[model samples]
Target chain A: MEKGGFCISTMASSNIAILLTIGVITVLVIQIIYIINRSRKPLHSKSPRSLSTLIVLGSGGHTAEMLNLLYVLQTERFKPRYYIAAATDNMSLQKAHVFEDSLLGKEAPEEVGRAEYMQIYRSREVGQSYITSVGTTLVAIAHALWLMIKIRPQVILCNGPGTCIPLCVIAFLFKVFGIRWSSIFYVESIARVRKLSLSGLLLYKLHMADQLFVQWPQLKEKYPRAHYVGRLM
Target chain B: MGDIDDIAKEKRVVFVTVGTTSFDALVRAVDTPEVKNELFKKGYTDILIQMGRGLYIPTKSTAENGSPALDYFTFSSSIADYLKSASLVISHAGSGSIFETLRLGKPLIVVVNEDLMDNHQSELAEELAERKHLYCARPQTLYKTISDMDPGSLVPYQPGDAKPVAELIYRYLGFPVD
Candidate 1:
C-alpha cells in the first residue's frame, strides 16, 4: 500500500508539471503575437504627404454632396492624395457611380461603379445610437481610427454626423503636427433653412470649428469664419 | 374580364413613399383631409404607400372597417416595375427617391423633411424645383403644390448643369489646379 501511494504521487506531480509547461507555452505564444502586431504596425505616426486631405460624408445627402465634390475633383488638376470615407448605408445613392477601390482613391472611372455592400454597411452605421450598443459603437470607432491612422490625411473635411463625428474624435486625438480640420454645409440662408430638431441645435453650437463653409452671405455675420462659398450643389 | 384585370385597367396607380426617419410624423402629415382629398381629386384610385427604411405602415386601413385607403408594400423588388407604370410618384425628398424619379422622367411631388436637423432636403428640393423638373412643398404647402402639378410638363434631367456643381466641389476640396 505504501509503495503504491508513492508511485501515485509521482504520477500526479508529472501530470502537473506537464500542465504547467503547456500553460507557460501558451503565455509565451500570446506574448509573441502581441509583440509582432505592435512591431508590424506602420511607423509613420503622422500624415505622410504634406497635402493629403480626408473627406468623410455621412450616409445620405452629405454623401451625395461629397459625390458631386468627388466628381469635380476628377476634372481638376490637383493631384493631392485624397481619402474619402463614406457612410456605408447611403451607398445606394452612389452605387451606380462609385466603387470601393475608387472611393479609397485606388482606381479609375471605368472601375468606379462597382460597389461592395459590406463597405456600405460599415460606413452607414456611423452616427447611429452608440450608447444603444456599446460593442458595435466601439467596433465602429476602431475601424474609423484604423483607416484614418493608416491614411494619415493632412486635413480632414466633414459634411455631417456619422463619419465626421468619429473622424473628428480620431483627428483630435492623434493628429501629429500639420493636419487641420474643416466643415461645410449647403444652406441658402439661415431663415431659408428649417432647423429640424436637436441635431440642428447641436450643429448651431459648433462654434470652435477651424472654419465653416455656408452658401448664404448672411451667415458670415453669425459665424464669421463661415466662408460664403456660394451654393455648392 | 376578371376583377384583378379590371382593377388593373381602371386603376391609375400611384405610389407614395416617405422617409423612414420620421415615419409616424410623415403619416400624420399625410393624414390631413387636404392631402387625402387631393389624392382622390387627382384621379388616383389604386395606391401603394411604401415607407422606406424605418417606418412600416401596419395596416392597409387606419382603423377597423375603414375602406382600404393605402396598400402597403413593406419591401418589394417590384417597386421599380410599379414606378414604370405609375402615373405619378409622391414621396419625401430623399435623394434615392428623387434620383429614381428623375431617372424615370416621371412627374413628382416631393415633401421635404421638415424634421431633419438641417432641413437638407429643402435645399435639394429647391434646387430640383428651380430647374422646373419637379414640384416641392412642405407639409403645410403640400396640398396646394400637388394640386398644381401638370404631368405633361415633366422633363428628364439634362446633364450639363451637373458639371458646375462638381467643379465647385473640386475647388472646395482643394484639388490641384491645372
Candidate 2:
C-alpha cells in the first residue's frame, strides 16, 4: 500500500512540473511574438507614400514659418491635412484660413473646409509660474493624447516652440509602444542662429524627432545629426 | 531752427513696435527725457508705438500742450499699414517684426533684449545688420544708435525666394518637388 502511495505521489509531482514547463514555454512564445511584432517596421515606413500630416502651429514666428513651409509642399498630396495651435492663438487659426484659401484657390470648397483647425491648451505661457506650468502641461498631455488617437497622423511637423512638447512626447510614446502610427519632424527656427532653442534641445537630447532640420550651418555643427537645410523663412 | 522746421514739415514718422511681447526695458529706454528731446530735435513729428503688453506707458508730454509725443496702443491688426507709412521703425529684435519691417523696405533699429534666457535676438540683429538690412542697438546704446541713424543708407531688404524653403520642406515630407 505504501509503495502504491509513493508511486501516485511521484506521478502527481511530475504532472505538476510538466504543467509548469508548458506554461513557461507558452509565456516565452507569446513574448517572442510580441517582440517580433514590435520590431516590425511601421506600416507607414513602407515608402514615400502620400500621408495625412499634422502641422503644429506655434504663436507668432512659428506660425508664419509653418505657413511658408506648407506653401512649399504639394498641398494636394497631403490630403486630410490638419493644423493645430494653442487655444489662445486665434491669430494662427486666421492665418491657417488664409493658407487654406491660397492653397484651395477655386478647387473644392468642401475639401478646403476639410483641412481642419484644432486648438489645445498651451503647456506654458511666458511669465507663468512653475505650478501653473505643471497644471497646464498635464492638461496639454491629455489633450494631445486624445488628438493623436483621433488624428492617427502618418507624419507630424513642428518648429521649436513650448507648445509642441506634449504632442512630441505623445508621438514618441506611441512609437515606443509599436503603435508606429506617426513620425515626428522638428525644424529649428530660422531665428536660432548659433544653438538649438529650448524645444530643439529637448527633442535632440531625447532622440524624439526622426528628422531635425536646422536653418543655419553653424547650428548643424553643434547638433551633428541635424540636417543643415538652408533658411526656411 | 529752420532745418528743424523743414524736417518737421516732412512729417517723418517713427514707429516703435515691441511686437506681441512686452519689453519694458525697450519702452523705458525710448521714453527717457533725453531720448524724447533727441527725437524732437531730429524732427520726428509723429511716433506710433505698438506697445503690445508692456506695463510702462509713455509719460513725457508732446511739444504741444505736453500731451506726449508718443501715441501707443496695446495691439493693432493693421501693423503692415503702419509699417508701410513709417519712415523708421524701432523694435525689439523679434523675427516677425524684423522680417515685416524688412519686407516693407523701412529702416529698422533692433534693440536686443539680453535678459531673456538664451535670447536669439542679438544674433538675429547682428546677422541682419551685417547684411545691411537693419541696425542693431543695445539698451544702453539705444539712444545713441537711434540719434545717429541715417535712413538713406539703409539697403532695401530683398528676401530670398520662398521656393527653396518650400522645396526643402516638400522633400522632408517625402514629396518630390517638381
**Worst 10-residue stretch by lDDT in candidate 2 chain A?**
A38-47
Task: Report how closely model 2 matches the true complex, as a DockQ value.
Answer: 0.35
Whole-model Cα lDDT of every candidate shown, in order:
0.54, 0.78
Query: What is the TM-score of each candidate's chain B when compared with the real chain B?
Result: 0.73, 0.83
Mind giving the per-residue lDDT tens digits that candidate 1 earns over B56-92? 3534643222222666654564357777887788778
Model 2 per-residue lDDT tens digits across residues A136-209: 88888889999988887878889968788888888766665657556677888878888798899998877777
DockQ of 1: 0.08
lDDT value, residue A59 of candidate 2: 80
